[model samples]
Target: MFKLGSKSDADILKSISPSMKVLSSREAKLILRVMDECIHQIEIVSFFPSLLENPEPFTKSLGENLLRTLKEHQELEERHKCLVLDGSHDQTNSQVALSAKAVQDSFRKIVRILRGTAEALRSKETQCAEDIVKMRDGLCELREIVLERLLTSPGEEKQLREMVLEVSQSHAANQVLIDSLEKDLAMAVKDKDEEQLRSTLQQKEKALQEFVGRTQQDAEKQTHSDQKTSEGKRARLQQEASQLNSQINNLIAANREAEVELRKKKYKEETEIENVIQKYDVEMGEKQTELEEMIKMHETDQTELRELEELYDVLDVEYSQIMEERQKAQELKELQEKELEIQSKAATVIQALWRGFCTRKALKSSAKSKKAKKGKGKKKK
Candidate 1:
């Protein structure tokens, strides 16, 4: 809309928007140019004749508001810088200062409410750092206790006693914090310094120190007492172990004596067992003699049985040979019957042939005589 052909105050302000969203020098230059053009347009509208008057007093009122808003923005920037300085640490001072400068520059374009909110965030960051410091100290104390327990609670009860002394020293240190806090509170109220709001904070710190001191003392006393008890118990256990060792030696001696008696008893039982075994061996020898006689009888019976088996084998061979001869005789009988049947068939065939030839010759002679008679009759006629 702010093309060169129709450049106007409103169009320039509209163009200034995108530049305002950016926080670079270029945006700042564009904003300055827009402000100048708006002021020029105000002058032209108020005094010049051709352009219609802006009866709403837009340019003058907007310029005044912008100026006021910019002043408020700058004030917020200063307040944020002060808060950051109050909270800055040796570790974060340089980097935080640089960041605060950038934030101040950007705040020039921001509205007052947003700048106030940023200040609140910085205050919260300050409180967070303070709380982190307190928590770190508390954890350090806890770690001391844990390390003392783990590293010191062995072999040397005197070391544990010294740790209890250190704990008392730390408690005295807490009393020092309480004294310092009381002095700070007294000075803060007497000086009428509203901004020195550390009294309540100091009170809280003092109270935390008191609580930590009491708890640490209680833990120290308990641990020292436990260490003493453990020492006593260790001594008792050593005494008990010595007594057990003595008892074990006496018991070992008694066991050796009992073992000697057991050995004598076992030797006596072994001699008695040897006598019984000799008797059983004599009985076994007599039984063995009887068994040998029975075995001789069994050998004779077995020889007779083997001879019977041989006789049966011979009989089986002779029976098989006779059955073979009988089979040959049956086969010869079949051959003879077949030869008789063939001879009878040949004799019957020869007799049938002779009978047929005689009958045929007689028939031929009779037919020839008849023929001769017929021929003689014809000749006589």
Candidate 2:
């Protein structure tokens, strides 16, 4: 609802919704990731109403959601810290508290903004939003700076300078917080002193009461002990020792009987175990014999298989030779058929030429005979 970065980012924020049904870890995680990327980019400063007359309009619920997202971020950060601190690290593993604390900030301004948004509504909202926006912008810039440093690792001198700047910024922030806390603590000095004094008095009184009770109990016991005699206590102790000796003798007898029983049981168990072992050994021997028989059978089968393979190979070679002979015969038969066809065609051509020659000769003879007959008739006339 805060105009985050782009229209697309805003749409994505709107799209994610909490369900009425209980959400699984996966869904919750997805929602959290989306909120981080989208909400982190929210332009809250520009949306400050008192500051921006034509502010980028946002819903109150949307603003609340923004605060909720920031809270989630803080919680996630705390969890990360816990995980880091409580992780199962080996002896060699260590952390660089100086560099980490120096570079990364505690995000005080953002947290203050969230607190303001939660309780003090409008009066502090503008300032809170401004601070939050500035922090976010600063974070982004810091990320970019780190990214650039990572991309091209500078010389020691340049790196030192950058690191010093970051460290100074964090130190200044921490100093300010310390100063503010000091002021608050100063204001509560009287109450704190009174509370400390009251707590001290109560502790001392309780201790004194416990001491008096112990002393009174001891005094009463001593007075009662004064009335009693040492001889009676000695007699009681002797009686107790006698009873203890009797109990020890009885326990020794019972232990001896138990030991005898345990030995008997152990002997029986050993006998049974031996019998079982012997039975298993017989079965194992029988199985070993069976396995040997199977192995022999397998060897016999292998010999037979080899013989069959040899026979197959011989038959295959003979079959190959027969196929080759058949192929050659078939080729010869095709050649003979071709030769026969060519001879038949040659005979037909020779017969057609001879028949043409004979017909021409007969026609010429008839024509000459007719001409002679015509000449004789004309001479007679």
Candidate 3:
């Protein structure tokens, strides 16, 4: 067992250099503490072999204690690494380095000892395996011996160790079986954990898929609503178009009626004019005859001339009234034409509105159908 001291690596470094002499006491104390820890670890490593060679009832705890010691040494290594890298560069640095190296060397030595222990464990395992096999074979032999003794002086046989060894072998085999069962149980537990995780993941994925499907369904429903809205709009537009068509037909019929009425009035006016012209020509002919007769009787009639002037005044009044009626008819015809033009423009606007609305409805219906199909596909999947 190597013992740590002030005279170990630390004290020597502290005494040799001015830069490190300022804190020799602290370094010496730390060196002693580190050495004591190393010594304790070495004892644990050394004691493990003895315990493995002849296992005590407390061998499990002894092995745990040995591992604890190894962990302590590892912790020391980490701490040393941190401290060394923390700019602790003094003349004491070499001494600290030496002490850390010593600790590392001790760990290597312990590893070597553990390896020997591992070999010893391997030997023990081989012996156990051999013993197990031998015990099994010996059980058969013992059974045969027991039967033989029963056939020949059965009560005289004294081979109790054979029976005990057979029982022990059975126990050992049972222990091996129990160990294997425990291992399998542990593996089964691990597999169950993994399976649980897998099932959870699958459940999450299923939920996600369900959510997506539901979203798709919602989209389809919205599309359907939009389609219905669009269809309703189209229906309204169609109704309006139908109404507009009715109005157009009515306008056309009204226009036709107006035109026919205008033609009839024109024909009546033309007939009236022809009647007036014929009357005027007949009157002129008669007047010329009367005038020729009057000339023949020139000596007799001033009163007759006065009566003719009054008749002429009445004809002039009738002519003025006819001219005013003609002017009114022409104004009415212009107004009817303007009304027809306005109706034509209105009909065109209604037709365009109807077409646009129909197109929108068709697009909406198609989109709805596609969305519904997609929703159905997801359901199938």
2 or 3: which has the higher lDDT? 3
Model 1 lDDT, residue 308, Cα: 96
lDDT of 3 by residue, 134-198 (tens): 55456556644433333332222233334445557766777788898899999999999998999
- Local distance difference test values of all predictions, in order: 0.63, 0.64, 0.66
Q: Candidate 1, residues 1-381: lDDT per residue as tens digits?
A: 112223455654443233223234565456555554443333322221111123133234334554454455456666666766665444466766676776666443433323323323323212224444555555555544433333332344454355456556766777788789989999978787655556777888999999999999999999999999999999999999999999999999999999999999999999999999999999999999999999999999999999999999999999999999999999999999999888888878877887888888889999999999999999999
Best by TM-score: 2
Query: TM-score for all predictions?
Result: 0.28, 0.33, 0.20
lDDT of 2 by residue, 116-231 (tens): 44333333445445567677777666655433333332354364465556557766777788899889998799788999999999999999999999999999998888758676
Sorted by lDDT, highest first, which candidate order results? Answer: 3, 2, 1
RMSD per prediction, one decimal?
Answer: 36.6, 21.5, 59.5
Query: Candidate 2, overall lDDT?
Result: 0.64
